[model samples]
Target: MKELRADIERAGLDTLSGRKAPRARVLLIAGRPGSGRSALAGELVRQVADRYPDGVLRARLSEPDGTRVPVGRAARELLDALEAPAPAGAAEDELGEALRTALADRRVLLLLDDAADAEQVDALLPDNPDCLAVVVSAGPLTGIADVRPCTLGGLDTKSAVEVLSRFTGSVRVTVDPRAAERLAEQCQGQPAALVLAGGWLAARPKAAVADLAGQLNADLGQGTVVGRVLRLVHASLPASAARTLRLLSLAPAGLVDPHTAAALAGCSVESARATLDDFVAHGLLHPVGGSSSPQYEVPCCLHPLLSALARDHERPAELQLARARMLERTVRLLQSCRAITETDSLRAREKLLEMPRSLRFPGPRAAADWLRVRRPALLASARLAVADGELDTLARRLMSQLVRAMVAHFGTRAAASDLYDVHGLVLDVAERRNLPRERAAALLNLGDLDARTGRTADALGRYRTALDAGREANDPYATGRAMESVGGAHLELGDYDRAADWFGRALTERLARGEGEDAARLYGRIGAAHTYAGRYGEALRNWRAAVAGHRRNGDVAAQARALSELARVQEYAGRLDESLRTCQEAVEWAGRAEDTRLQAALHLRLADSFQHLGDPASAALHRGTAERMLAEEALEEDSEPEHGANACEIRSSSAEE
Candidate 1:
């Protein structure tokens, strides 16, 4: 035991002053393991020994199992301290009276260590003013009504370092003060870790405390003090709370809404909420920022502990089940976010019908806020599923919904990064399942999103991967989609030849299948790439073929797209009459298709066409229509066919469309 020489000397005041000067009636010393609780109590006993003529009394009221020590046993010890003989079968009430009567007019001192509870100490407390009582326990005896209590946690930094210095020797701790401080912090202010860590470093006194802290941190897994602490805390929790805490540790964003918590825990919201506060009281979590709705985040200090606990305690099947629940909840939220945004979408209406009544978030804004805050956690969860192995399918499904939600809300930077991560995971899942069609689909989506976000190189890589996957499956539709994405990426990268080659390949396959919308889209893309390369005649021909195919297939958005490309080609060809005619036809097609942005652009083109045709009044009228439509977006908002394509800029007012 480390001598308590310093603290012992300071405890001198315990004996010198009595009740005549408002004496120290209670000397409550409490601390964690190896923190001198016994030593401090011993020194205080020595200071007050002279006044207590009846002599000192000591009682231990704890079992290793934490079951409370019986009050009768404690009473017996107290009676013995009073030199009162009691029969072995004495009842607790009789012993308590005998102890109180014995100390009624005498000065006495009591030291009760590792006490079990209030009742154990109640019988030992001296009743007279001439007595001093000391109590020590791991927790504050909150159930105790009368006696003042002192509960111990950990030593403060200075005292803790001082305690460590006793072992490491003064020179080392004094030499590098800052490293010593960080060592204390890494110990998590726990005296046991500090002492163990100090002993670890002190054995090799030449070693830096910082170096030891680093090495110890690197090795802080199942065998570490931190690990044991989690095991104990986890084992100490109720079965239900322990399960919930494990599942919640897997939450990506740290903060969770009550519904998500319920979904993750497989419990009612009220139950999950109660569990949440229980953790908070134990200093395991803290409140998260923002309150578009209120949220609570698990503290970082507790995260590693929770993680270790989950890894150690949760069986694979149990953890997988928990993950499934959280993902199911995520998919529901993603669908909800989409549904609440699009007023006329039948899919949206149907999704809403399927939503659980307890699917919370008071309003659309509230839901958005929740998503914003929990975004990191959700994304991290997706990553974790893939990393956990055998969870490929779950990860794929999770990423699909996650990408949709990310696209609908959040910035390009965040969404693009998320898209890349999900797409990467999707490949692994597809490979494992031997689902080439699904692989192609995943790659195509990732590539398309990448191209839209201006990540041309990344887009090309994904597109080529999709092409390979499609060829392996011998799936013509998947292959055609892959080619189209590759063409788009090449066009963005200024590789006109490569773009045209891929587009032609996609077009031939689509034609063989007699899929006109598929054909129209490829033809329009080829036309655009040709136009970008200044190949006017080829662009015009491809655009005309695209327009004819789109019109025959009743593909309104495709028709408008082809018309816009053809008009641009005609305008660039320096044929004023042909350009004017094409621009007017483009406007007619856009109007027919209810393509707002295309219509607006066509109006502006018409203004240019009229100016070239020497009609100033007509040009002015077209210009106003174009400007008004561009500003209001009334045509687009009211348009029945607002397609998901990169043809127009979508301005998300929030993370929602």
Candidate 2:
């Protein structure tokens, strides 16, 4: 704390805006794991916590294995700690507002420990300048503004000796002070290593400290000080305890609750809990606070040792078996989670129900809670499983199930980027296995995601690949979808002529397959492209054909949609009376379809047509009706964007069909 204080004073103050102000309200303490960064941050908070009357709040922002805690999850934790009520499934930005609002009037000391990066800290910063945030992280957290950085190295020899004496007896250190100093030197001044050495000595009260030091020097010839001390600590444990410790390296996110530990160790949850508690007591693992279950994690410095030990002692088959169990358990949990969110889709619900239920969640809430906590680990597992080609087909199947579940819970747009990596993995597998149908499906999905994110060029490229794969697989449905996507991408890029050509090709295919409804939708897409290109004659013909097809298919809503597009083309062609008549009939169709939003938007279009015909009173009446309907209920209006002040509007809503 004293050293940090000196650095803080050196950082000085800021005088921006012609006024003196403290340089930073946030302090960053960066160090390696097991270097006592958390302890240092805690001490700093203790020294100045009383300065902020609202109280101090500390949050762990990453798992031990270094997966960043999702921003939404982190915000939820902060709001919960602040006693602020947050709506369920709130977005990350919404949760951020809730956190900032809760902290707005309070002068608080916030300690964000084990932060993965600066973004995590930035999202959780309070709006109030009176609040202070002390962020602890392994990284330097560069490029963040107004941060006072305190980098922690190993402890000094004096502090190290005191730590050892506190853990061991002072008399033991007093008897052979030189040997004690040598032991601290061997520890490389790391507090964790020193404590482990102390615990080793404390466990054996009569053992000579000098002899143990010599033994370590002889046994661990070229190893790091941390590695040497960890070996000694791990070696002293019982066989079962040591085995459990090694298997814990397989634990997801390096976080081990009782149930997870039991799966890894093939034991009962109660027994695993007791074993973890014993490790906590002996300082082999640190107990995580603010968690519902009694959880413990091996220190990061010691984690590598556990991994190496597991690889050396555990058989390959044993490791694989354990991993499979964890994956299977995760798959079952995701199935339940995806099932609960699929209330509207019967096909998706049936798929979820057909999945084997080796594990069961008590309710939907429990299922959602588990998925929220374990999403990172589940994704990590999916990537690893896909990369490991020798694994069973169950791994790939699990990945598919997980992707479906996440997309069901979060909308496609919200979850697109999160699922992109997994989609890439699936594509790789399909290409490697020479499965043309799967490859086409994967490419189509990726192209759709790219289009949604505004990557028009990339989307077009992927769609081309999908089209070729679909043709190779002799799948007409895939081919039609790919063609449509390519046309949509062209439309997004403002290449309306090319878009119209591709939509024509797709429409031909749908008509040949007797898909009348889809053919109607494709015709509407073609009409939109022509309208965008200022080709009113071609646009009018395609839209008329679209309306006839929709009427033949008995689709009242779709006929209303097609008629709305036809009205815009008619208005563009200097036929105000015809346009006004088409819009009126379109409004009647929308009413029959019970689509209030579409009805209101058509009324507005009617008003536009009337005004163009030089009739102010009729225009005003239609405009008033549209406004009244829009205000009565929450609805989204779809209408053409008006071209050059008096020209016709070009509606592209049919492109979504």
Which candidate wins on lDDT? 2
Q: Alpha carbon lDDT of residue 264, candidate 1? A: 77
TM-score per model over all chains: 0.59, 0.72
lDDT of 1: 0.69
lDDT of 2: 0.77
Check candidate 1 and list the clashing pairs.
Answer: 252-377, 253-377, 409-655
The 10-residue segment of model 2 with minimum total lDDT is 643-652
lDDT of 1 by residue, 1-657 (tens): 123223323333424553232322554565654454655677767865886787788876753224466676577656755666444334578767777777777777788876766667666676675677777766566554333444455668887788678778888877888888877876666755565566556546677877866665565565546455445455557898878877777666466667667887899878888877666554455666556555687543345566666777788787778878887777777767655655588887777877776663456666567676666567667766777776676677777777776666654443554566577677777877888988898888777666665667987998898899999999988888888888878888899989999999989998898887878878888888888898989999999998898889987777776777687678778877887787787788788777677777777777777876788899789878877877788654665343456264222111221
- RMSD per candidate (Å) reads 25.0, 8.2
- Residues 260-355 of candidate 2: C-alpha lDDT, one tens digit per residue: 677778877678888888777556778866534356666766776788888988998998887777776667767778777767889857776676
> After TM-score superposition, what is the CA distance of residue 283 in candidate 1 from its true location, in Å?
1.6
lDDT of each: 0.69, 0.77
